[model samples]
Target: MRTDDVLEVMNELVAFVRVAEAGSFSAAARQHGQTPSAVSRQVARLEKVMGVALLQRSTRQLRLTEAGLDVLERGREMVAAAQATVRVAEGHVGVPRGRVRISAPKAFARQVLQQPLLSFLQRCPEVDLHLMVVDRPVDALREGVDLVIRLTDDPPPGMVARALMPVRQLLLASPAYLSGRPPVRTPEDLMAHSCLSLGEQERDNRWRWVRGGDVVEVAVSGRYTVNHSEMRLAAVEAGLGVGCVPDFVARDALAAGRVVQLLPDWVFDNHYQGTAYLLFAASRHTAPKVRALIDHLVAALGPCAQPV
Candidate 1:
């Protein structure tokens, strides 16, 4: 191919990358202010030129073929280089200035990140941030988010992840409620008491405790079952039942004597409890603004750091 033909091929490859990263042609089009059909054609053209099918399309989501994955890495590098070139030309060289979209959980944002994010804005005036605070799942790759705060033992692949802190499940109950109920000496003793859980699913009421090599799983139910951490903490404070909540959510309550931890020796495993992680898409180039915010959060939320 000649020089102009090469440029067209590069454009098609870049479009394919965007569609793949966005998880759908429609999402990529929306993000880029283009039509889905246009994006779809670009990807199809690229596939035809490359002589290989890149994606396996399904009703719900797009899945990458082996060749598509390899092409994605190269195309991502091309996009990153183009972005860096534009930034340099725009006089943003080595400067952390721009809007960064982020996704974080609601309770974690309120309890931990909100204040630090405010402080970061004050420290870096040129960098703007958009925080999408929600408890529901958000895909960092397809959501147009620059950063994501997640608590998971195993983070999704194809992303760069940093472990910030351990999220513990602290078993708790109000002093008044615990005063009336039998002491929870063993894990089996929880069967006698009402246990509050997220109850978003059947397994939320089921909990597993780990102590060294020993493991204990219990099934306990309560009248109030809500997915919100703060709401569950409120229920525990009202002496509704025993509760297993995130340590950070129960921190203020535990310090204020509103609730007391039942078993300090055992650790519980749940959907919510895991190592807190900061994640971003893997790339040869990371923006300065995203790096700044990640460093600030790690300093504030990491172990041995002073609480805000």
Candidate 2:
């Protein structure tokens, strides 16, 4: 096929895959921002090009033929490869004038990263930042996000991750809550108190503390459960319970004595211990905007902190 013919065929195949996945031409049309007839025509064009019927369609239901299933499996890989190729080409130019989409946790995006990013943007006027604040991991390529900031002990597979910093996890409790309670000098003392929970993971309800060479895991329970780390920190400030949170998030509160460190000698280590990584496709290294943002983040977060 000619180059343009190949491109048209790939586009049609992709449209067919979308229709099959969505289970309706109309749904795929909405997804692709094209008319239903246009979507149907594209699928038909794909079937004609491939010399196979791709879909079994009816007023009641849409079903994929065996050829459609084969195309779906192969088409996804083709699309991904094509995208990676484009990204690689974009990276090499280093023009740095396009929008850079980033995904990060809401609290970190708002509290920790936003100010620094804003400052970076002020200095680099050519780049536009699109920040998607969420509490869950996003598929960087599929979501069309240029980069992602994740707090993880181990970086996710198949991406170039640049760690920003080592977040110090600390155990904190409000002075009001500790007024009558004895000082907690060890992990064992936490057994007598309530611990706030963050994230839905069962592991979040457990506390891990390290002292000298020993590491301890204590199962903790609380009256409040929150998905956002900021909310958990606020609950700790309100004297509701002892909460373990990142030092950066609670730094001001700790300084103001709103929340005092509990078990000062026993540190929470290797649990909730992770560096914030600026994850992106390795191909994006050449893109000017992506490279600029990565450089800014490394400078802001520090170079020695995150491995390249």
Q: What is candidate 1's local distance difference test score?
A: 0.86
lDDT of 2 at 129: 93
RMSD after CA superposition, every candidate: 16.8, 14.8
Pairs in clash, predicted candidate 1? none
lDDT per residue (tens digit) for residues 1-308 in model 2: 35576576777878887887888988989987999999899888988777788889889888888877887898889888988999867755756676889998876788789887999789878788999998778999899998899888788788888988877778899989998986777787787888887757768777777788899988878788886667889999898988888878888998888988877677786545577888988773457787888888888885675545
Off by over 4 Å in 2: 1-95, 269-271, 305-308
lDDT agreement with native, every candidate: 0.86, 0.82
Q: Which candidate number maximizes lDDT? A: 1
My TM-score estimates for the predictions, one after another, are: 0.70, 0.66
TM-score computed on alpha carbons, candidate 1: 0.70
Q: Which runs of model 1 end up more than 4 angstroms from their true locations? A: 1-92, 303-308
Residue-level lDDT for 246 in candidate 1:
92
RMSD of candidate 2 to the true fold?
14.8
